[model samples]
Target: MELSPTERTRLRRLREQGRSDRAALFAVLGAGFVCHLGVVLDGAPMVVPTVYGFDDDFLYFHGSVASRSLAGGQTVCVTVTHVDGLVLARSVFEHGVNYRSAMVYGLPRALDGDDKLAGLRVLSEHAAPGQWDYARRPSRKELAATSIFALSLDEASVKIAEGPPGDGDGPDAALGLWAGVVPIESVRRPPEPDPALPGDITAPAHITALAT
Candidate 1:
């Protein structure tokens, strides 16, 4: 299904880079576990970096129960972005970055009971695929101290910018200067075991697999 753009999600600038495909939105969100959440707290605007997870219908994030930023039932904007490369052009004005990003806007709902636990599971697995089962589950006391928020995925905007610089045919091309893409990639390194762990215990297969 294609993303249905709402008034706030409509792309007004560089519309060519805007994507309406739901798959594009999913790809951007799946590539990164962190997101910037924008909200108002105590009548002031705040943006906080937090871990996020999403399914086909909703996006979930959590914070301490005392965190004012995580208080639900208010409008919020969550954004996830991945930078692919630098687009070097002959002219500085034409230079840009290749990237994929998604912005989700909605009034989040505070989750509780079974819904809260399920949201936490989705958050855990999204960051570390199999660790939700590999590690111990949250205790009742821990759950009581946490607050989870769920935002609908029905309102979102996705944009992807890629390929070479855009000044190849422009007057800048005659400048006789170098112009190309400098690629950037996020690579996972070998897992570092806890210093206090037992010598006989090794990194789990699922964790070690990330390095490959």
Candidate 2:
């Protein structure tokens, strides 16, 4: 259950954390929307940011067939992160972040036909749970124009940080500084529609539900 060296080094508190925890990894992946995918292109490493979806055993990404980042024949390193808050300690040196992040390393397989369609649907729904079903599905030509890739969830790791900073009760404790966590969260706002649409038109139930 050892985390890969590359992934493990990304965290500052490696000694204080364990990266092989599956529950921690899944939590990070479940809370994120965008993932940065790294692949080799022309012998150079290329990191592409895209929306992704993941299950227990696989990670899915979709794009146009013309996307070289996905269609390239190389392994990929994908990372998803959710920053929950900023922990401000009495001393700047002890300032830290409350976050959950996951990194997965694997080769991607281009899905064809039915699998491709299903993968796209999964990704879309993942980004917006009810939006996919409430919106129009892809047409035949649309499906043909798209490409979906799936990565096995074999090699991966998760790192997490929570609660207050380390300086809360350190030498800086008597510094008389106001220190605490500035909690951060992502919230979905109400959807705005085009002005040209009918004045009587209202938002879909799914769109209205986004306020939650």
Candidate 3:
């Protein structure tokens, strides 16, 4: 789908190279495990880190209904980002970061009953890949104890800034400052099973590949 003119212009870097398609957007969302949920509580803005998942059109977040950040039916903004590297150049002003990020703006729709249970499953799977299927399903009472919200991706933007710094070979290079890229990565360690669990327990495939 084509991005609105406003959206295209809003993202400074993306206006030139960022993608504005459903496929690109979904790929970013799938790779992300954490999202910053921004909500307006009593006219104040609050951003909370939370787990989230998404299909093609809507993104989902699950939390306690009693959460102060999500109380009532307040509007929210969600953002997910990956810091790829630190770009160091001869000039401090040219120093920057390489990253991929997405911003979502919408009102959260509360999910209850079966929908809430399914939303939780989606969240779990997104955070841990195949672990959702390997784990036991939630009981009816357990489902009732949790709350979930679905936000449409009808209005959002994806922004990405990548590649080497522009000052690497410019006049600023004569300054003799060390200039290079410092890559950042996220990795997961082996699972630490509970001590009370049976000794025969083994790590699942999802738990094994989380270090990426």
Candidate topping TM-score:
1
Return whichever of 1 and 3 wins on lDDT.
Answer: 1
lDDT tens readout by residue for model 1, 46-100: 8888888999999998755326655635788989999999999998888999999
TM-score of 1: 0.96
lDDT of 3 by residue, 96-208 (tens): 99888888877788888777877787888788878778888888777767778889887777777788888866898788778888999776777788889899987776787
**What tens digits encode model 2's per-residue C-alpha lDDT throughout 1-212?**
44445553455556565466666677787776688887777777777788888777788986443257657667778888888899988877888899877878887999989888878877887777787787899899988877788887777877777888788667888888899999999988888898998989998887777674
Candidate 1 runs further than 4 Å off = 65-72
Model 2 stretches with alpha carbons more than 4 Å out? 1-15, 19-21, 63-66
Clashing pairs in 2: none
Report the Cα lDDT for residue 125, model 2.
Answer: 76
> Between candidates 1 and 3, which one is better according to TM-score?
1
* Residue 49 error, candidate 3, Å: 0.5
Q: Write down the TM-score of every candidate.
A: 0.96, 0.85, 0.87
